[model samples]
Target: MTKKVAILGAGSWGTALAMVLEENGHDVRIWSHKAKQADEINFKHTNKFYLPAVVLADSIKATHHIEEAIKDVDVIVFVVPTKAIREVAKKVVPFLTKPMVIVHASKGLEQESHKRISEILEEEIPESKRQAVVALSGPSHAEEVALKDLTTITAASTNEDASKVVQELFMNDYFRIYTNDDIIGVELGAALKNIIAVGAGALQGLGYGDNAKAALMTRGLAEISRLGVAFGADSITFLGLSGVGDLIVTCTSTHSRNWRAGHMLGKGNSLKEVLESMGMVVEGIATTKAAYELAQEKGIEMPITAAIYEVLYNGAKVEDIIVSLMQREGKSEA
Candidate 1:
């Protein structure tokens, strides 16, 4: 059955997903904060700023007004930046009059609060207004996914029926979807991998070899798994699509905003300078802070997260952080 899906962000990831839904014969409307972007998507059938090479389908419409986009929509996908999720969700609740599945492609935790995307959705939008909250995440990059590259992702929710609905909606020959009930693990793996991706970029910027990158990614997964387990996520979840799969792709890919941002930082640019150059939301910058705070509050030791946080926030040199990490007391790798 065809559904009316409202993707509440017109960024690259959002636009790419709009194409997926459009291909599936769903009525897709993308909401952009900037009216000019919406106009480009509607009239020009292109979003050059985000998906420069891909031609968006005319079946996918665009709207600047949230109410118009959400009106009678069966599914609302929040693909906005983590900072904007609350603001966007607030606007969505007022227009919501029916039971619509809430899905978000954002991969970052709210700063300081350290609340995952699903938790923020539950807090911002009352339970009565939404039918189910689903987190759609994995290793898929917007640029590649837009190119119709073979991609697989997981739709995770506490609600099995809701997750299956999303899985069925987006599945196709090139793009595949799986369902998982471990929302916490899937969300954490999605968010935390960016932090490690930044580290991977930093290593590249510092001209480190593959051995160093491999070590960083392996230990990065360990720290992520530790914190994830502390927060009630299944330890096994880290080994799945949202965890190891995501880490490998995000850490090595040039298309990753977090990796790009970190590569710049490692190449000796300030965080401010790096961010100014990217023109995109490098989620790891914010996620680093949230993960650092969460680790402290929960008494979980996340060395890599700490190193990234210090490099971004405290002006600590990556070299120094690496040396310190190397000198730390050794323990068995679990």
Candidate 2:
């Protein structure tokens, strides 16, 4: 069955997903905050800055007006940055007249509230307008998915049917979707792994090899699972696509802005310089702060996250932090 889908962002990921929906024979309209971006997408069928050298499907349309884009869409996929999730949701509220499957592909906890993306959507979008809130997340990169590479992701929601709806809407030969009910784990895993990705990239930037990367990734999952379990997430979800899978790809891939930003930082570039240079939202940088604060408040011992946080926010040297991490008291790897 065909569906009308409103994607509320025009970044690389948004454009990539639009391609998928267009290929799947759905009516896809993207809402960009910038009129220039929307105009480019409409006139040239391209989002040059975000998805460089890639032509978007001619059938996929874009508009700056939120109301216009979402007027009658069956599903609303929020792909904006974590900080902008609430703001965008508020803009969509007035335009929403019917219930829709509200899906968030943006992965990061809100820095101010330390709330997950779905929590912000649920808080901002009225229940009368949303049939269910679903989180679509995994290791899949926008670049790979745009190239029609084989990718698998998870659609998680408390409402089983809602997740299945998302699975059916997105799954294709190149892009496969699985359903999971662990929304808490799914969202948290999606959000928290970015922090570890930054750390992993830092390791690479410091000339560390696979052994170090492997160690960071392994212990990173342990701490992520610890904090996530504390937040009532299923422990096993950490082993699945949204957790370890996301952590692996984001940490190692050049396609990851978070990893690139961390690499810059590890090479001794300032955070401001790194951000300005990338000209993209590095989700891990902000996520480190949120996860650090949340962990401290909840008394979770996330040493790696704390180390990354100090390096990012406290002007701590990456090498010194690395040394400190290595010198920490030994403990069992449970």
Candidate 3:
């Protein structure tokens, strides 16, 4: 059974997902902000800006016009970055019809509002127009996914039926999809782990080895779990793929944009310099601010995230931050 799926965004993740859906025999129409990108996808069968080497399926089409992308689509997958979700949602709203299931593949909270991506979607899309909202997340990276390598991810929503539908739409032999009802936990796990990945990358860039990286990943989960629990997420969610699994992969993998950006920062490049050079959303930088703000508001202790905040915003040297974290008062691990 083929379904019409509108994918909002054409970045690496979006293009990878579009490929996955197209492989699953769905009609995937991708909406790119840049007309040139849409043209490349439609005419050249490649998204040169993101997944350069991979050729997109001919079944997957691209359009710069939001109206064309969403027209008659059964499902809408929002793959834009966290900061751009609201703005893009607004632009797509006029084309939205009633009873359409919306799936957000983005991972992060709004910077100042601290709202999850689902919440942002709900706020941007009217209630009458929304049928179901789902969040897809896990340790999967776009580069690996684009190559059709084995990958697994979770699809979560308050609506079980919608999650099942999404699971069916994306699940395949090479790409596995699990359905979960804990939308908040799933979304938080997806968002918070990036912050930890940044810390891990920083450690690696500072000449640390596996032992140090392992410790950082372990303790990073603790910080992420604390914040998630404070915000009413299930503790066990952090132990799953979206949490610990994602934390490990992003921190260690060379393909992680966030980790690479942090690595450059740890090697003594300024944030502006690194971001300008990379020319893509690092995510963890904005997520650091949101996590720090959430911790302050909820009165939760997240030493690792706090330290990252200091390094990123307060001009604390990465070396000094690492030393201070190591020298902090020790406590029994629960």
Candidate 4:
């Protein structure tokens, strides 16, 4: 069945998803914020900004106009960066109709509002015009996904049918999709793991070995689970694909943008310098603020997140941050 799929954002993840949908025998329309990017995908079949080497599928089309992309589309996949999601949602809201399943692929909560991507979507889009809201997340990296490598991810929604539909839409020989009902846990796992991946990258940059990375990842999962539990997510969900699975991959993989950014920061580069050099959005930076704020508001203990926040925002030296984390009183793992 060829369904019309509209993807908002033509970044690496967005483009990779569009390719997946196209390969799944669906017609995909992608909207890029930049006209040149849209033209590159639509005409040249190449998105130089994100997936430089991979050629996009012919079934995928691109446009700068939101309405053009969403009009008559069966499913709308929101793939814009977290900071830009609200603005894009507002732009698309006026054109939306009923029975449109919204699947958000972006990770990270809103900084000040502390809203998840689905929450923002609910607020921006009218209830009468919305259908099922779904989130797809896992350890899958956009770069590898674009190359058609094997990747596994979970599609979560309150609506079981919608989750299955999404799973069918994107699942392929190289891509495996699982379904989950715990939307909160899925989103939290996706967002929180990036923070830990940054910490893992910092360890690597500081010339630390696998022992340090493993310790960071393990303790990082604990902090993530604590925050998720505080937010009403199931504790077991943290052990699933969206949780520990994503964390392990992002923390250990060199392809993670958040990890790479942290590596530069650990090498004594300024935040501004690192971000400017990276060019792409490293979601963990903004997510760290949002996660930290949520932890404080909910009275949850997230020492790893707190340390990253201090290092990124308070100009704390990497070595000092490490010392502070190490000196914290240790407790038995429950």
Count of steric clashes across candidates, in order: 0, 0, 0, 0
TM-score of each: 0.99, 0.99, 0.98, 0.98
> Clashing residue pairs, candidate 1?
none
In model 2, which runs have C-alpha deviations exceeding 4 angstroms? none
RMSD of each: 0.8, 0.7, 0.9, 0.9
Kindly list the per-residue Cα lDDT of model 4 for residues 6-110, writing each as its tens digit: 999888899999988888899899998899888887788898878778987766889999989999999999999999989998999888865688999999999
In the predicted model 4, the residue pairs found to clash are: none
lDDT of every model, 2 decimals: 0.93, 0.93, 0.90, 0.91
Q: For model 3, how does the per-residue alpha-carbon lDDT over 57-151 read when each residue is reduced to its tens digit?
A: 78789999999999999999999999999999999888776778999999998988999999999999998888889999998999899998999
Per-residue CA lDDT of candidate 1, range 9-121, in tens?
99999999999999999999999989999999999999998888999887889999999999988999999999999989998888889777999999999986888999999
lDDT score for residue 321 of model 3: 90
Q: What is the lDDT of residue 157 in candidate 3?
A: 91
